[model samples]
Target: MKGPCTPCTTPAALTRIGCLCAMSCALACVCAPLRAQTSTFNGAVALSSQLVDRGLAITPATPILQAAASWTSASGWSAGVSGALQTRDPGHLSEGLAQVSRAWSLSSAWQMQADLLYYDYPGNERARLFDRTEAGIDWIYRDVLTVGLSATSMTHGADHQPRGAADVDFHWPLAGHFSLALGAGVAQYLVSPYDSYGYVHRPPPGVYGYGHAGLFWSHGAWRIELDRIATDPAVTRHGGNLVAQPWVGTVSWSF
Candidate 1:
């Protein structure tokens, strides 16, 4: 009869609609965690000291304060803004910086990351505005070791010439949520007449080489870092300033 046929088709239609709804709900549940894991916010502060020696005179030690806020995504995307103030007795300079990075997972034991940074330096005597751009890559091996390489270019407001630099770093993890990093690099100032107190008139084709070592520890909500930096052939040419070096200690809380 026509009546029987109508009833039979209605039940089958209802069943199909219910199945589609269930499948949609299942997919949403599976994706919710991945979306939630991708975004994070963090803040930190640090203090550092630097010893500068010019071939002619050695100036008093310098202290620097740095603060930053960053956001990172679970899929390896990150962005951050930072500011720094450096003071030596009565003289000081301030800088603002921004950076972005992306990370790719290559395998269970290996990963790669790339980043770019921009900086603005104010109160510079030689150039009121200086622009610096950098690109770098990091490789992770065995969840304990990482190596990185980076290149940077710096431009002054007045000069057409741009400075170039290269950097390399190695990092290893230690016990108690601690890690150690070592770095070495070279930077060349292309313009000889550039006049920042940090890079005042001295030599054409100015070259500086540096080494850095640091330790980082994390416990509960607290993170701490201790770092040392040393440069050869002193960037400046004052007496008793044969070596230019800086040491840093930082502490931060994670939310």
Candidate 2:
């Protein structure tokens, strides 16, 4: 038998770590605002499907429900909580996640945010329970461009993995009533002692990256996005390949 696969320690991992460090320094240089001002409650439903590997596929034809509420004080400080229930196929796999976030305006053009996410995956051999924490800062320039850097660390039972990401987004107004947002990002996952897929067999540490660009059209209370996303080979081996295509559609409604 071939020697157990070695864990990944790729150049991409180093680059991601460097980006996270840079974001931290940038966030520290600005003074955070002291108050919050606005709040909102929102809900949405969506359906998704994807093909995994060459032979496995899942069609989440049923709708998934999600809801969230947020409050921002007068000083630009904010806090929010959200939850979702998603099901793809009966007797196969289902997941639910709850998350909370806090954000502060560091300046007129810079903001910092932190979040904790708890996820439950039921009836899946890959993962049953997971929890993660993420922190990041966003820089908004010219009222149209936003750049962000975030770091995420997840724990499943005793396994631990950390990931880092950098993203840039641009917003464009359409017809004065609609808006479009386009962005792309890259993510790198740090290897750990645990197997890549929950099995005892060790798998090589892989670099996973993705790019996304989307268009959102808003009309009254309804919003729709035509999105395209693509992931690297590392993610393909990590069970996210089912919907790995570069295209997907998402819709939302507000009341």
Candidate 3:
């Protein structure tokens, strides 16, 4: 079983651990009061038809079980953790995350959020190489539309460079409890010569785009969604077909 580096003996690892601890303590101090009062806690469990991330498929067509829990304070401070495990190999985690975020209302109709995230992949070597800290900012409009940007400095990969992504999404309400969801995004990376995605360009040439269109239905705490997911031909050719299914479906219940 793969696990996080322990003992913090190395200088680099120790620095990373120190930074993480400092951030955690800071956020805890800020949110402690609000958490004692008007904070809300939410959780969800879902079954997904496949696992996908940033235009790349992380799993074949095999289904995965996912769970997430979050706490949001009335003052817009939030923290969350989420994880998924592929049913085909349920003994190990496929993906995991810990995140902290702050949101502000830009106006009556616009809101912005800034967040820090950590990603972990336990069993897949290629995926694990990209595991790192990510920072993101997002602008949301009227709970229906959002534009988001994120970047990461990937020290675990051979490149040890930064990568970024931008995405836009729209959720349009229909007559009843159903909605239309559409989104698209692109990722840019400085491809290492030894990168698993297989590009060996000197100027760092790895760019891919992805998009999804789907319908969502919600009633009470239960939600059902089906999306037709697609990636650019380049992603399919390089990222491997095993992680590139055409359609993904999910059913989730939240509380």
Candidate 4:
């Protein structure tokens, strides 16, 4: 479900700024109660030091503004959209995502969810090569631990073969709204041709691993988190820039 795709930088300072303002206003809505059998809507806005997805860094040493909103029905189905834009000069989009999922409870201590996710990289010519749909399922234990597995086919490319991935994550609560988060995952990719920025050099198709350890604290509608991410050294040695970032921090408000 992962591939080597370079982030794009477009000239649209005004556009990006407008998006930031709009999202900020939208997310300022009052927090609503989320009760069983009741539909709910939620929105959040955040500032992060880097844009990382699936343990891969999407932006190089740049801060970003992100916003997301989701709606969930009483039937355990949900849909959401999220976007991130660079915070510096000539700000442009980093990435956008759309997701739909369904959840079910199997027992008092266990639950499962199936998800379909789509990734979009606007203004990047190679976007078509990496943008694709990922289908996966996750199993959760007591809302603390999760195990996920997914696969996707690189349909835009000539080969049209499937890539598979799996990940494990743990979120343990400490005290007073503080928690420790840990995750590790590996992804498969097809070698991509070189580009002007040399973002990706032709390499063999294979699997690479990435992981993160972080701490989180929440109060009311606000949450803050800090994480240190690391990827297989081979990711860089193979001309993939997913290893350039070491630390990521974020402050978010959700309602």
Give one digit per residue, the lDDT tens place, for model 2 in 83-190: 333444354434433434455556666555444444444544333333345555555553356666666666554545566777666657788566665655565543
Q: Summing lDDT over every window of 10 consecutive residues in candidate 2, give the lowest-scoring window.
A: 1-10
List the candidates' TM-scores in order.
0.63, 0.62, 0.80, 0.80
Off by over 4 Å in 2: 1-63, 87-95, 122-130, 190-205, 233-243
Which ranking of candidates, highest TM-score first? 4, 3, 1, 2
**Over the stretch 1-255, how does candidate 3's per-residue lDDT look in tens digits?**
001111101111101111111111222222332335678666667777776665465556677777766677778777777777778888988777777777777787776777777778887554666577777777767656767777777756356566887777766889789977677777774233235545423323467677777787777767777777767775544444324577777777665
lDDT of 3 at 176: 82
What C-alpha lDDT do the candidate models reach, one value each?
A: 0.43, 0.39, 0.58, 0.57
Off by over 4 Å in 1: 1-36, 50-62, 86-93, 123-130, 142-144, 158-164, 175-178, 190-194, 198-206, 234-243
TM-score of decoy 3:
0.80
Q: In candidate 1, what residue range of length 10 has the lowest lDDT sum?
A: 1-10
Query: Mind giving the per-residue lDDT tens digits that candidate 1 earns over 1-255?
Result: 000000001111101110111111111121222354657665555444432111111123345554556666666666666555555533444555566766666776766666676655564332233456656565655434445555556654544454555555454769989977565656554323334343443443466665556686766556566656555544434212233335544454433
Return the TM-score for candidate 4, rounded to 2 decimals: 0.80
Model 2 scores a C-alpha lDDT of 0.39
lDDT of 4 at 62: 73
Candidate 3 displacement at residue 69 in angstroms: 0.7
| Candidate with the greatest lDDT versus the true structure | 3
Better-scoring candidate (lDDT), 2 or 4: 4
